[model samples]
Target: MNKQFIVNLPVRQLDKSKAFFSALGFSFKAEFTNENAAFMIVVEDCIYAMLTTEPFFQSLTGKPVARATEANEVVLCLSCESREEVDSLIAKAAAAGARIPHPAEDHGFMYDQGFEDIDGHLWNLVWTESQA
Candidate 1:
């Protein structure tokens, strides 16, 4: 059996969320995009993030959407090819209005940095050395 991962996140506005992620070099699937939500293609068809309006998201989950600014949800992490790539991606996110929540940490074998998106979703960019 084949399986894929799709993360659902609530956004106050679809267009704004689309733009924010686009600026960070993400693209959406036109077939899954509508006025209320967008299927952000995180890694082609293997991974995706469904950015949906609060009301729509709430309906699907049968619960009130958590105010991203006031509550902790889940942190999304992405692997990068190199430490430079991690820094570069975080820099782009920051330039696109994301807030850097903390400084980048270098642990000799791994480097990690974090940023909060426009909707207050925390994302960690990491680059790790291959074990010998």
Candidate 2:
């Protein structure tokens, strides 16, 4: 069986975040699409918990969402088959409206970059030496 994983993210604007990931070629699973949130399919192995602002998500967690710049709660790491793939996704994310996390860095054995979604969620795109 294919084990499924889900990551819930608090978003100020559901539609905006949905559109952003959509631009990056991700599609929502219709069954999980709703007014409060949209389930974004990152890949067969991953899913995003794209939550709406206010009562929708707040009521569930009973707390404020973490600011990406202020916290290091978690960084979602995803693998790529090659360095070019990591580079491509970073470019695509910038075009899709995500704030670039940092300049691309290399460590001889790995390459990586990232961006913050509208909701302050961090996605780490990586390409390892094995992939290179």
Clash totals for all candidate models: 0, 0
Compose the digit string of candidate 2's lDDT tens values, residues 56-107: 7778888876666578768889888888999888888899888896998899
Over 4 Å off, model 2: 45-48
What are the lDDT figures for the candidates, one per model? 0.91, 0.79
**lDDT at residue 42 of model 2 (Cα atoms):** 77
Model 1 CA deviation exceeding 4 Å by range: none
True lDDT of residue 44, candidate 2 = 64
> Which candidate tops TM-score?
1
Clashing pairs in 2: none
Best by lDDT: 1
- Candidates in order, TM-scores: namely 0.95, 0.86
- TM-score of the candidate numbered 2? 0.86
lDDT of 1 by residue, 1-132 (tens): 457899999999889889989988999999989998999998875889999999999999798889878888989998889999898889889999899999999999999999999999899999999991
Could you tell me the C-alpha RMSD of candidate 1 in Å? 1.2
